[model samples]
Target chain A: EAGVVQSPRYKIIEKKQPVAFWCNPISGHNTLYWYRQNLGQGPELLIRYENEEAVDDSQLPKDRFSAERLKGVDSTLKIQPAELGDSAVYLCASSGGFGETQYFGPGTRLLVL
Target chain B: QQQVKQSPQSLIVQKGGISIINCAYENTAFDYFPWYQQFPGKGPALLIAIRPDVSEKKEGRFTISFNKSAKQFSLHIMDSQPGDSATYFCAASVGGYNKLIFGAGTRLAVHP
Candidate 1:
C-alpha cells in the first residue's frame, strides 16, 4: 500500500508571509499527525487527529499555527506570518488506529528568510 | 519528566561491526518505547519497538534491550552495514498512541 503523502517537498518563503502544508494519509488510516522537526533534532508533535476530531493539539502554537483535517483523510497545517524561526521540516504521518505504528511521508522542508 | 535523553550525538562503526544506541527516560509511566531511523531529506521510519513487559526483543539484525528498573533502553544493530547509516531516535509514550517524547537522536555512520 502507498505510504503517507505530503505536498511541496520543499518550500521557501520570506518572513511574515503565510505558508501552508498539505498531507494525505495512507488508505484506511484513521489517525493522522503533524510534526515539526528542527535541524539535529527529532520530530516534535504539533497536532494529532483521530478521524475528524483533534485529540491532541496542546503543543501547537495557536497564535500563528493552525491545522485541520476536514474529511479525516487529508490534513493541512498553516502558519500565518511565518517567522524566521519557523524554518524546519514539517512531517505528516498516519496510522491504522490509535496505538498503531505510524507511517510517515517525505515531509515538506520550509525555509523562511 | 517529559524528556527522553539519548547519548552519543554521533557514532561511527565499521561494516560487520556492532552499532549500539542508548536512551533513558524519567517518566516511569512510559510503557512503550520505539526507535526510528531517518535518512537525509526523508521522514523517520519505525525501526523497532519494545514494551516494558519484555526485557528484550529482536528482529532480524535489530535488537531492543529494555531495562525497566533503570528506565533505559538501547538499540543494537548486529553486523552493521553501510546502509544502516542514518539518524536514529528513541521515543517513549505512556498508554500507547499518546504524546511521544523523543530523544535528541544519534547519527550513526557505518563505514564500509
Candidate 2:
C-alpha cells in the first residue's frame, strides 16, 4: 500500500510571499492531519480532517494559515505573507479511523527567508 | 502547555547495549502512549505504543514500559545497533487517533 504523499519535498520562499503545500493521504484513510515540525522538536498538529470536515483546528493560525481537505482524500495547507518563523517541515499523515495508527508522508521542508 | 516531558536530550549507546528513553505526562486522561522514530530528513515513523492497562509491551527489539500510577513511560531498545540511531519522540493522546501531545524528543546515537 502506498503511504501518504506530499508534494515539493523542499520549498524556499521570501518573507511576505505566499506558500502552499499539498498532500495526498493513503487509500481508504478516513482521517488526515497536517502538522508543522520545527528544528529539534516534534511535529505539532495544525489541522485535522475527518472525511472532509475539519474536526480539530484549534492550533491552526487562522489569520495567516488556512487548510482545506476537499473530498477527504487530498489536502492543502497555505500560508500567506510568510514569516521567517514559518520556516519548518510540513508533514501530512493519514489514518483509517480516528483512533488508528497514523502513517506519515515524507513532508515538505519550507524555508522562508 | 507542555503535557509530556522527556529526559536525556541526547544519548550515546554502544552496539549490543541497551538504549532507554523516558517520558512523563501530566494528563491522567491520556490513555495511549506511542513512540516515534525519525531520521534526519524523513518524517517520524511509529515505533511502539502502549495503553495504561499494560505495564509492558514488547515488539521484537523494542519494548514500552508503562507505569500508570506514575504517568510515565519508557522505550527500551535491546541489542541496539547503529541503525537505531535516530531522534525518538514520545507522545500521548486521550485516545488512539486523537490529537497527540509530544515530548521534546531524544536523539540517540548508537555507535558500532
**Candidate 2 whole-model C-alpha lDDT, 0 to 1:** 0.93
Q: Candidate 1 has which clashing residue pairs, if any?
A: none
lDDT of 2 by residue, A12-72 (tens): 9999999999999999999999999998888999999999999999999999999998887
> Top lDDT: which candidate number?
1
Please state the Cα-based DockQ of model 2 relative to the true two-chain complex: 0.88
Report the C-alpha lDDT of model 1 over B1-112, residue by residue, as the tens digit: 9999998899999999999999999999998999999999888999999999999999999999999999899999999999999999999998786678889999999999
Per-residue lDDT for A82-101 in model 1, tens only? 99999999999999998899
Which lDDT values do the candidates have, in the order given?
A: 0.94, 0.93
Chain A TM-score vs. truth, each candidate: 0.99, 0.98
User: Model 2 - which docking category?
Assistant: high
Which predicted model would earn the best DockQ?
2
Deviation in Å, model 1, residue A45 alpha carbon? 0.4
Clashing pairs in 2: A99-B96
